[model samples]
Target chain A: MEILNLEGTEDTPKIILDKKNGIFEISGRSLPEDSAEFYRPVLEWIEKYSSDSNPSTEFVFKLEYFNTASSKLILDVLSALEDIKGMKILWYFHEDDEDMEEAGQEFSELVEIPFEFKTY
Target chain B: MNFIYDLHRTMMSQKLILVFQGDFTQESTKSILSMAERNLDSSGEESSIKRKVFNVMVEALQNIVKHSDELVDGQVRSHAAIFLIGKEANRYSIMTGNPIRKENVVKLKGALDRINGLDKDGLKDLYKEIIKNTTISDKGGAGLGFVDMARKSGEKLEFEFPEMNEEYCFFCLKVNVPRDNE
Candidate 1:
């Protein structure tokens, strides 16, 4: 498995997926214009990772802000992760932003996989 | 001409305004929104104000990217549109306008009508419902963006569809944000 790294932008975020450590992190603002384009590779990588089966895969999402399109993509990412065995996802939300916290909780409810929400 | 000038002056007096014309792709929208964020951050504005401007700007620009009628080289472009942000007394106002296809007017009307009918609580429920039921469309028109915008703005979303031609119309939306002092 190979790692994926993308720099964060004013409207996007930095994505660091470390295949060696089995730790995937997406952090920063994410309002990508072509969210499909921006997220396609990450989703594909996760799909590939799911099949290969790491002992334990930890996914981290630390987003300051994201638009509606990005929100949908996030859901897609979570759903993809849910299919993988031994996958653990941790969603970090800013303490000051109730909206973001609620969004994480909402996603937890929708997906069957357990999602741990942590405030930073 | 004088009336136009007066209207411009009046708008200027309200708050900061940024307008975009031509192609408004995802990259361009990201740039514009980032610029706004940078400006607000440098100015040391209140978080509430910053969030309000950010939410409204995102919603308006995304709408343009998804729905604008004019296309340039196969890409959707903003046609005769304006985006304005103004602070009046203690409140901020965000407004946007763009040309729309006549065929899409009915759907746009339905979207806005559903948005307007919802109160904050109702909008929240609607957003959750839509998010759960609607498949993520390529064009980003799950109708949840408008609902989220309205809920965040804490203001009634206002819109208009003026007849422009046999095939197109002008659609406009205005949302207000109350300043912290208010």
Candidate 2:
């Protein structure tokens, strides 16, 4: 299986998708200028990963900040995992970051994936 | 000569903390966010309020980059825009202005008016509906920025479209985020 790892930048998030070690995570600021273009490969990878099997997948979204355009792309990322049966999401937010917490709650409500929110 | 001092007096009178006027690009947007983040951090702003302001700032700045008239007369204009942040006793006001095609003004105005008319629940529903249905444009816009800004700031978006010329107009938007949580 091919692993995907992208370093976080000043405006974009770091993404890691490794089935071998069972680590699927996206973290940091996500205000990329071209969000759709930025997330295309990530979506494609997730699509391919869905075809193959994993007993269980734990995806983490520990985003500190994301623009509205990135919000739609994030939703697309979640939707791409709809076919995976044993999918769980771990969302992390800062202690006083109500907006991030609410963002997690909203996403949990939108998708079928179960989410466990962690406060840092 | 004295115009610089006059401009400073005006900024001070308005309680303006930061102002940027130039062609807004992705690089400039990143710089603006970083500078504003530092300003808020130094002011001892609460985490929640700072996040709201930051979110609104991103949307406002990106809005300029995505919608402004970068092309005019088959030539690429500068995408010149202005951004301002004013610190007040009760709230932080974010304002942005950019040139837009005159023909597109009506549609943009209608969208803003609809957003202003909605309450909290209404805005939330609109946001959810858009995210569920709309496709991100090639320019990476989902038309969700204004709605997100309204929801985050918990205030009606103030706007205007003053005529700049026959084919273009100046689009201005202002959003105020309360300093203290209500």
Candidate 3:
């Protein structure tokens, strides 16, 4: 279980998945042209990580902006994380951005996993 | 006879105008945006104007990419569209048009109307609220893009939904950026 780090771009966001430390972070803008292609590897890594180790994963999502497609992909990631036991996901959002906070709540509602929302 | 001369005079007095017709997908929009950016940079335009132009362009391009209905080659290729960027006196205007479904016209019109009605402070509040409340729609109706454009331009967003057919309509949006200070 290694780590995955991607630099943020104007159209995409930085993704950090540290499997070793059981920390996952996605931050910045995410308006990718092809959401599926951009998120496939991240999804696959999460799937593999959940299956291999029952690590106490801490998922952090700090998105300034993301499109509709990216929203769906984020849901997929949340669902995958739910599959793993003893996983703790902390969804962080800016204090001013109630929309993102509500989005986290929505995702939490859909998943059976223990998801917490923290405002910064 | 006089009308023709007036038209010619108007054309001569107007700045360069370029119209892009068709469905502006992500790829094509990206190309056009990059072109606009480069052209503006080379023209030694003021940074403020450049930024406003880029912001308005991005918002308009994103709208077309996500919402336009008419498609070519079995995919929406920015056809049935008209994009115009030109200067009228000291103001720069960027306008984009696309064929929209009749079902979407009312909603889009309402959105634009609301956007146009807001002042700068109102728009800022609306943007903050929209960004915090609006659910990310599956088909690109978060409504933040328009607000962003309004904020960037420091001007009201103008739009029209003209009838095209029973099932579709022509949607046009115009954003203005004044260059007098620059």
User: What DockQ results for candidate 1?
Assistant: 0.47
In the range B1-182, model 1's lDDT, one tens digit per residue, is: 79988877875775555656666677777778777778778877787577767877887888887766454434335646666666565677777888877787898789888888878778878877887777657675555788888887877888898877676678888888777634
Q: What tens digits encode model 3's per-residue C-alpha lDDT throughout A4-30?
A: 889998778999988777668999877
lDDT of 3 by residue, B109-140 (tens): 78878888989778867754654456556655
Fraction of real interface contacts that model 3 preserves:
0.06
lDDT of each: 0.78, 0.90, 0.73
Clashes of 1: 4
- The better-scoring model by DockQ among 1 and 3 is 1
Stretches of candidate 3 off by over 4 Å are A7-10, A13-30, A34-120, B1-14, B70-78
Per-residue error at A45 for model 3, in Å?
9.2
Candidate with the greatest TM-score versus the true structure: 2
DockQ, in order, for the candidates?
A: 0.47, 0.86, 0.10
Model 1, residue B80: distance off in Å is 1.5
Say which prediction, candidate 1 or candidate 2, comes out ahead on lDDT: 2
True contacts kept of each: 0.28, 0.81, 0.06
